[model samples]
Target: MSEKALVHIIEDDAFLSKALSRLLGAAGYRTLVYGTANDFLTQLATLESGCILLDMNLPGINGMELHAQLRMQANRMPLIYLTGEGSIALSVQAIKNGAEDFLTKPVQKDALLNAIAHAFDQFQIDDLQHHRQQELKRRLGSLTVREKEVFDLLILGLLNKQIAYQLGNAERTVKAHRHSVMEKMCANSLAELVLMATELGLLDKTS
Candidate 1:
């Protein structure tokens, strides 16, 4: 439903690309057309929020190879594969690699629009998670080194006395650090602190 959302079309066929662009534009969407996978790759980092409609048979890098590169680059945009001669194996691999959908050539208008809508909806959800992670990182940054140490131990189900023993600090000092950790992390309960730690991948780092 976002007017600013742009659909990226990476089809080598000039006529089909133009027609697809027109179709998306008319349906209240913006579009970027690339004649080659390399062209799209060049602008991948700067590409705005939206999904990708990639032709499976590009001239150089090809669609699946491009998808792999995007994965390596950590581009989480939704992708829909368009293939003129889609095989079961190819479609299966595409889906396994996290493609939103696979459509045969001469795609239906309604189908294409619906796929785009679904992909954009997913983009919104991903964007929200991304922002939440960023905020968590910011809050984590606000902690002092000692406070971070206290936070790490506290989330590990450690008592203040246990943490003080491990850190060679007095119990009262450990208690003060824990209080600062809770305030800076904006967590009211141990459960809330643990959830933030999980969201920020701090739990993974500790484990």
Candidate 2:
């Protein structure tokens, strides 16, 4: 219902584009229509978080290719392929390439709406993940160099003495650094610290 959940319509056919916009608008969705893929790409950053209703056949970049490009660019916008009957194979490929959903040409209203609803649901999940990652990055950024070193070792299941030996520091100094790491990361215990490290990709980076 909010403008932030806009349905971006990229269809070549003027009539169908307008009709889709009207339909979505009547259902309490905001929409922005474009006649070509290029137009949509040009204004992509300005668009709010939402789903894309993309016709599989566009003038410049075809829907399949555009979908691939979007993925390559790390675009998280959920895509619903509005393809023709003959483009079933392409639609499958689109889904395989990370499209959220698809619909054949002459799409049923209920089916389209349902797909849009599902896409928005996915967007919510993705948005939450993105924000969580950002928060983790901020927390990581708050760590001092020594605290980060201590954190890396702590998550590696190291004892304070072992970490002190590895970092060429006293055990008491290592303990202080470890405490700082846990506090900055907002971790309550060693197990929670390890989980936070795992979630922040710190484990993978060290491994």
**Which candidate ranks first by TM-score, i.e. highest?**
2
The clash count for each model shown is 0, 0
User: What does the lDDT read for residue 111 in candidate 2?
Assistant: 97
Shift of residue 14 alpha carbon in model 1, Å: 1.9
* lDDT of every predicted structure (CA atoms): 0.91, 0.87
**Model 1: residue 5 alpha-carbon error in angstroms:** 2.0
**Candidate 1 residues 1-207, lDDT tens each?**
465678899999999999999998999889999999999988877878578999999999999999999999888889999999998999998999999999998789999999888988877888899999998899999999999999999989999999999999999999999999989988999999999999988899898
- For model 2 the local lDDT of residue 59 reads 88
Per lDDT, the best of the predicted structures is: 1
CA displacement after TM-score superposition, residue 99 of candidate 2 (Å) = 1.0
